[model samples]
Target: MTQTLEHEEVRIHRGPRSGLPLIVAVHSRALGPAVGGCRMRRYDGWRAGLADALRLSEAMTYKCAVSGLDFGGGKSVIVLDRNAPVTPELRAAALTDMGEFIASFDGTYRAGPDVGTSPADMVVLRRSTPHVYCLPEEHGGTGDSGAPTATGVLAALRAGARHVFGSASFAGRTVVVSGFGSVGSRVAAGLAADGARVLVSDVDGGRRDAARRSGYGWVEPADALGTAADILVPAAVGGVLTPETAARLAVRLVVGPANNQLSDDTVADTLAARGIVWVPDFVASAGGVVHTLGRESEGLDHGAAVRRVEGIGDTVRLLLKGAENPLREAKALVGRRLPPG
Candidate 1:
């Protein structure tokens, strides 16, 4: 099936240097120049990668709009064959190819780190274009965005606590954090520090020992959705909050740093029907971009950047408390910020 694009522009280029297929989707330019991360992942096919680029880019539109970032939404994807192993030589070449692709956009689109890409990869990307962001701090850019992202998640979680539990603390609460990666580890640690009983899950069995060392219970990935807890933090991939998962969710509140958490817009209604306070992923996950743009683009000091990231709690509070339907209110907020065509 051919994927239809409602975006401002979508381009697929066969990398002249690496022979990899690179996709860049610019979903909107209503507010300003488009900005999003470069996601390099192994896909069954380039079409699947293109679909991800389309969906993630559109989510970034709402992410930026709702977070009050001036930038619009865009994303770049490097599609790798699922069966092929990525050699260091091949990885370097792909970054160069991605850089070249972003360079072609001039400044209309900028690339940052996401998923498989990193600040080191951004350094390699700088070899081709200046539109790359979150380069290592020593290179005049903020380093890994995971910390700020976790900070924002915790902030949102606190607000969710207040809205759902009538308290602002996670003390005596049981929070399930799915995906024990960089951001998930940090969120789990924060929850533990706040006296919450944190259960961590990851598809990677290697992380089990680390979760145990942190005094967190380990739940198998398959059981995470149905595990009873006060909250569920999905810090991994998108599309985890589908209708089927929402039906069995044992948590009172759902929020995390995962982008495109809902499989579709209708999942929001399904969650509402289930009585789950599902904070929009864009709102909860904006801290990384918020902090990066604050420090790099806005010339904010470190303290200012940190403070701005913490403001996500306030945003979540307003969204949850102001209306009967938070997702509807959030979409309305995004609609207001976006200029009419």
Candidate 2:
């Protein structure tokens, strides 16, 4: 069975030999072309993969809208087989075919990097399609967007700090980052640099080792959510802040780059009722999209992109202080730019 949302288009593509299940969901294009990252994961089934694509694409629309970008939101999910051996040739064949499939959109949808994908993979994608972004600097594209993404998250964290603790500095505050990937590592490093007691956790031992090397404290992934912290940043996966986990959270603020952090809409009310200030993931994680759009569409230099990302702090502060429901406020902000349904 195929599923989709209103004002959305879902396309399923299959590779010849690799049998890659590529699901692309274009959630909206009311503003401009749809843009989002390409995610690769081993899902339980096609239904779960499609659901993820639809949800992430819709979230991208809100993220772009809240970030003041002119593009709409879309996402591509490549479902991998857990038992299959991922040889180099198989990977290349799959990506090449996926690139061709993306190129068929003719810029209506653009794909970058997400979970299990990278700038290097974007390079592979460019081998077949010109519709890719976030390539290496030598390739004349914006490099990893994680830096600016982390930058924006840090800015929003400070804004949340001020809103909750009456100070903007991270000095003397305890922060737990639940992911140590490209974005999470940068956030942890930034917090450590700013004198925050940064603790990091990841399922990967290598990432935990890296966090230790960077002088940040380490927590096991199992204990990350329940760890004592002034701020809890779920930077890795989504649906982590479920009602059960939210009930046990030991933090005053929830701010991170994880998309769809809440398991469901009701979790927002759960967090709020628990007195935990929740910064909308779209608002907190928009720096990457903002940087990518600024550089790719607006011809912005690195410094200009950084400056634009810094504005995320102001936006978060405004939303937190002025709106009773920040997520609804963000959606309304996007709705104003979109044509009426």
Best of the candidates, lDDT: 1
Per-residue C-alpha lDDT of model 2 across residues 1-341, encoded as one tens digit per residue:
98534746789988776788888899999889999999888888777888999999999999988888889999998888867778888787878878888988999999999988888899988887888999988998897899999999999999989999999988999999999988999998888888899999999888867777888999999999999889999899999989999899999998999999988888888888888889999999999999988988899988999999999999889888856667667677778877877
Q: Backbone clashes in each candidate structure, one number apiece?
A: 0, 0
Worst 10-residue lDDT window for candidate 2 reads: 322-331
TM-score of each: 0.98, 0.96
Instruction: Give one digit per residue, the lDDT tens place, for model 1 in 25-59.
Output: 99999998899999999999999999999999999
lDDT of each: 0.93, 0.88
Model 2 residue runs over 4 Å out of place are 1-4
Taking all chains together, the TM-score of candidate 1 against the true structure is 0.98
RMSD of 2: 1.9
